[model samples]
Target: MASSLLKTYKKFKWLPFGNWLFSKAICKRAPYFATIKPKVTHLSSGRICAEMPNRRAVHNHIGTVHAIAQCNLAELCAGVVTDATVPNHTHRWIPKGMTVQYLKKADSDLKAQAQIPLPREWKDKEDLIVPVEVFNSDGVKVFHADITMYITEKS
Candidate 1:
């Protein structure tokens, strides 16, 4: 199933407005994802990339992108990549916890990238760690997160 979805995404990913349409579909499932308006730049097994604009809605009092907003982007990248990598019929995953670091002020649009080595085989259940890095428009590393996802077999 994951492979099938990836194929569908790849087929349309190059079309005009394709990324936006894909993002909208994701936001529909996770409504809060709409708040940041994330645009998925890439999606493949074990890798995902997304970006969000630094706008007023996501700004902090001091005018930088809010820390939580960055966290949201990180989670979105991580979740999408995980979903693409894990076999849907055999395993499912949910975020267990996240450890985040705010390295610098996010004063511009932010891009988040997450990657993990594809597992050779799926365990019935396990804790998988997915690391996400967030960078500002200038390509400066602004935030980082290690999201732990609990993977379990579908009953």
Candidate 2:
């Protein structure tokens, strides 16, 4: 069975601006995510891609996208992918921690892609690591994050 999030994605992905609507629905549920104004371009069982504009709100003193803003994009992709991959009604997940590296200055709009392997079975609890990479519009990798999610079977 597909997760509710994945079901929502499939239902809306074919309509006009559907992906953007799906992203907004997610933000409505998790309000803090609205800060990045994310647009989820692609979402699947184990992979997701999202983008954020390089506007003044996300810029730093040097005029590059702020590091924390990049981190927010990373987390958004990671969390969504994790939710899409996990079995609905059987398991739930929360971010445990994150390790990140900023490789280059982000001067353009940024896109983030996150990937994780699908779990074959459920456990009482496990730490799943989702890896995400953010790239500039030129396709240069600018930031990377390894997000740890603590997943557990629902009671």
Question: RMSD of each candidate?
Answer: 1.4, 1.1
Per-residue accuracy of model 1 over 10-59 as CA lDDT, tens digit each: 87698898888888888998999999999998999999989999899999
- What tens-digit string does per-residue lDDT give for candidate 2 at 1-155? 78989999999999999999999999999998899899999999999999999999989899999999999999999999999998868889999999999999999999999988765676768999899999999999999999999999998
Which sections of candidate 1 miss by over 4 Å?
1-4
Error of model 2, residue 49, in angstroms: 0.7
Compared with the true structure, all predictions reach lDDT values of 0.89, 0.93
Predicted candidate 1: what Cα RMSD to the true structure? 1.4
**Candidate 2: residue 61 Cα off by (Å):** 0.8
**Worst-scoring 10-residue span by lDDT in model 2:** 116-125
Best by TM-score: 2
Using lDDT as the measure, the top candidate is 2
- TM-scores of the candidates are 0.94, 0.96
lDDT of 1 at 92: 88
